[model samples]
Target: MKTEAEIKVAIETYGDMIRRICFLHLKQYADVEDIFQNVFFKYATKREAFDSAEHEKAWLIRVTINACHDFLGSWFKKKAVLTEDFSQFQIDPHSDQGHLLDIVMTLSPKYRDIIYLYYYEGYKIVEIAALLKKNENTIHTRLRRAKQELKEKLGGDYFD
Candidate 1:
């Protein structure tokens, strides 16, 4: 069992990253919340000590991704095909940033994940490749293709 201080530190350090990963993978807020809770629960219960802070963050990311996959595969999730209305929550009415996020969310999970980790989470290609356990070249190819797809979808040189 992990100590309270350790659990608290983990939560404070990686909470946003975990939530962002969950949100990117899941469509519904309810499901995201469930997976988010489950990820922390798993962190608190797991016994392995991380070799470094980077290792700990990577482990959390992996666990969060796995939990999202598990949630998607659950029988209840399979039976329901619900989607959330994004209009209910808006931080800024005039910001076009939300539109970009909407476009990214339209991507398939593979591309969406790579985009989120690379662009949003500030991970380099090498880092993302290592985190996702894919070849560095594969990450490069996916990112290139994903950018093209996004460009086509958004039109008029959306990415710089």
Candidate 2:
């Protein structure tokens, strides 16, 4: 069993990161909570040692992503509209940052995941490809395409 201090540290260090990831994939608070707990539960139960903090964070991220996929596959997941109201998920919906997230959440999961990992998590294309088990070229292509789509969705002044 992991020590309490370790668990607490992990939660403190990565809780918001995990929450944001879960929120990106799931809209309903209940679903997000379930997946978020599942990620930590798996973390608590796993007995693997990490080479570094980065490795540990990467493991948690990968597990959290898998947990989101599992939740989506579960029978309990309702097939509701993908773009439900995310006001509660935002820190400040009126702000431009939140507006950007609102736009990002409108994207399909493929684009959303890539964008989050690339931009929010500060992972490079090659690193994202490795983490996601996709070809590096595929990650590059998706990022390029996703940027174009975001630009179109946000109009010409998006990055300005």
Candidate 3:
């Protein structure tokens, strides 16, 4: 059995990174808490036989990203409306980030995931390619396409 110390170490090291990944996927306050709980639960189950720390961290991140995808698939939510309110935002009041996020949600999954991992998670394009298990060229192309798509949907005048 893995000791509690090992589990504690993983949480301390990668908790926020995992949380950001989960938020990117689930994108709902309630769903986030549920997913967060699920991540730790799964970790405990798997920790019965411990791997190296590097292996464990990578596994945790991979599972968090997959969990988000699974959550989205199971929910079957429709495309986001452009009219959602942004009053809950507390940063860059003049910056219209929420509207941009709404526009991003309307994007194709390929684009949205690339953008989330690259921008929100601060993963380099190369790092993102490794994590998502896609070719470097493919990640580059998708990121370019995702940005172009977002700009078109939001228009140059949005939130300005």
TM-score on alpha carbons, each prediction = 0.89, 0.89, 0.67
Error of 1 at 21 (Å): 1.0
Q: Compare candidates 2 and 3 on TM-score and give the better one.
A: 2
Comparing 2 with 3 on lDDT, the higher-scoring candidate is 2
- Tens-place lDDT digits, model 2, residues 9-86: 999999999999998998667777888888888888888778899889889889988889888887767565556665
Candidate 2 Cα RMSD (Å): 2.8
Q: What tens-digit string does per-residue lDDT give for candidate 1 at 1-160? A: 7899998989899998888888778856677778888888998899988899988988999889888988888898889867667646433435688788778888888898899888887899999999889999999999998999999998968777
Q: Candidate 3 regions off by >4 Å? A: 1-9, 48-57, 75-95, 157-160
Q: lDDT tens string, model 3, 63-90? A: 8878877877773445544355544632
At residue 78, candidate 2 shows an lDDT of 55
Clash list (residue pairs), candidate 1: none
lDDT of each: 0.85, 0.85, 0.71
User: Clashing pairs in model 2?
Assistant: none
